[model samples]
Target: MRVGIAGGGIAGLTLAWLLSESHEVVLLEERPRLGGNVKSVLTAADGGPCAIDLGVRETPVEVSPVWRHIAAAVGVSAGDLVATTASRVVLRKHERSPLWVSAADPTDTARPVTTGGPAYRAMARFADESARWETEGMSWDVTVGDVLDSWPLPSTAVRHLLCALPASLHGCTTDEVRSLSARAVGTTFTPPHTVPRTTYLRSGNSSLVHGLAAGARPARLLLGTGLRAVRRAGEGFELVDSAGAVHATDVVALALPADHALAALSGLAGAGAWRTALKAVEYREVTYVLHHDPYGMPENRRTWSAGNTTVDGNRSETTTWYGPSLGVDLFVSQLDHRAGRPREELARSSFRATLPTPQACRARQRLGAIHEGQRLLFLGHCTTPVETQEAAMASAVAVAQHLTPCGKRLRDYLEGG
Candidate 1:
């Protein structure tokens, strides 16, 4: 079979790599480079050129079985993985004090603000409640606001965890966070009993991208060629490229975002259902700025953690990632439209992310039905919940399972075989 993959991100790359073993694969990317959101940058340092990931950074190994399997499969040595503790602090604008802080590291002299108080009790309660909520199998339509309203949490706790924290993580406004699915938000922010173990690629995420590309060995790797449109041929599909060229393939897997994928299928017949579902998946534009200045950190440097979020009214909450892994003062801040550009910005890039609203989550569920009995398929964030690399890769694995005989073998590989 001849497979055509659109959008050369992790999902597309993984699908191509899986299919290339038995089929001729052609991967198309609009950008000149691969690794769509897995962008890493090198900066001058005293020891050497330190790599900083401007896009996807850390992966929690416990929850990221597929990512771990892929990294190891691609020859990523154990030395390349650096284990790190994920910590966070939340601050309000113009306030010298922090609204909430995780337990301080042993090296820090400053004590945590919410060690024992209403905020502390609220945090503890939330953890327990969210865990129960998960086990209770809460409805998908339940909004974060609905959950928060039911809780007897203090305003500060609500601001810190449910509002600012999720807003910072998703690169959306606090108000926008209210409409998001409680199940999704709970899955992300629910505190575990112990500190979760996470890891970062010592050389950066691009190493995995390079490995996938090298292994995939697609017959035609078309970078800088966007998929303009898709039309049904007699038995297969015809993909129109940006340069006015049409490529025919036995199967088509669109690993692009919902909007991008929908736009390309404008010429396809019987695509109304696909278009409607795609439109329900709302997206927000997030800009990441890498810089030397602490644009979004708390006023006190001692309270700094791996992730620092600042909450301000009507503005999107900003999260700054302090580069403890790089052993440098480098910082990456996620900003929305409201937050102005950073002063000492070294580099800036923007990306579109799907908001996991109840509507959007429902839309994602319908994608499987839309692709039923059709050669056209959807993968990546469009087909999965939460925009993590692990989810993206898992979606690709599903597609590979559907199209090839090695699907069970691949699933076993992802399950740590």
Candidate 2:
């Protein structure tokens, strides 16, 4: 079969790699690059052998079975993984609470985010229940909002702190937290607060991205050209390119985002249900900042090596440090969702990450409608309902299992085998 994959993100790349073995593959990327948001930048003087990821930094080890397998296959082995050693947390509150104290400082007078108080109990209960749900094989019909409403102690500010897990981690606002599945909230690989910091590939995710690209080695890799249109070509699909050329294929797997995929299929046949599902998916955009400012930090100091979250109306902000230990004195701040910090003042520019909501999960479940009348497929965070690398890879694998001749065998052959 002739397989064409739209979007060269992790999902699209994985799909192309999986299907390429059994089919003639074409990987189309709207951007000039292949790894959608897996961007790594060198700060150690161009090619000086040091860099930092401006996006998708954390690579939680336990949660990334699929990614790890693929990475190893592509030669980006386990040895490339690096872990951060910051367990101390600094707490800064907007309301009436303890001032910012260094958790790492032995003599500093700061309290942990969890002091066995109401918020701690609430968080503990949330984690415990999420684990229970996982063990019991239960359906989380309720949202994370419901879980917060389950407890009625402290203040809204404190509740916002609890709500940040879904908002900051999952990508939504406090208002949208009610739309996040309770199960997803409870069952995430590593709840952010407990770990203090997250694990990452020491070399950055670009290595993993490059590995997949090399493994796929698509026969025709289209970069820097956007898909202009998509329509039926007899029994198969014809993808019109930006320069008004067309590439017809036996099968098309749309590994694009819901919006991008929907637009590409504007006049294509069998796109009705797919369009509807794509339209139903809701997303929140966040501005990610890498800077030296400690405005959001406790005492404006580097003591808060770990990210700290604060609530603003329905939105929240998290500050994470890429400090001296990490080879810099910069802090990566996830400014309020959909909002940007001072651009001219800060030395850093803003980057964005997609946040999935409960509505997105609903849309994700409805993707069967897209598959009903079309061989054209969907993948990525839009399909998986979470904006994590593992989720994106899992969605790719799931779709690959359905479309390829021996996809099951190929997927299992993880080591770039």
Among residues 3 or more apart in sequence or in different chains, the pairs in candidate 1 whose N, CA or C atoms overlap within 3 Å are none
* lDDT tens per residue, model 2, 1-417: 888788888888888877776789887888888787687665552235555676777766565778767777778866677656443332334543432222433333454434456656666667778778789955546677676677675776566656664667645666777767777666542333454334667677788888888878655778987777888888888888777878889878887767777889888765687788788765556556665556566553444555566556776666666662355555667755434463322323343445444556677766733443457777887676556788788788877767763664364664343
- Per-residue lDDT tens digits of candidate 1, residues 264-318? 9876889898898899998777778788777777767777878887777745455
Q: Which stretches of candidate 2 lie over 4 Å from their true place?
A: 45-49, 85-113, 136-141, 170-172, 188-197, 293-295, 300-303, 324-327, 336-355, 368-374, 405-417
Best by TM-score: 1
Alpha-carbon runs more than 4 Å astray in model 1: 104-110, 337-343, 369-373, 407-416
Give candidate 2's whole-model lDDT.
0.66
User: What TM-score number comes out for model 1?
Assistant: 0.93
Per-model tally of clashing residue pairs: 0, 3
TM-score of every candidate relative to the true structure: 0.93, 0.84
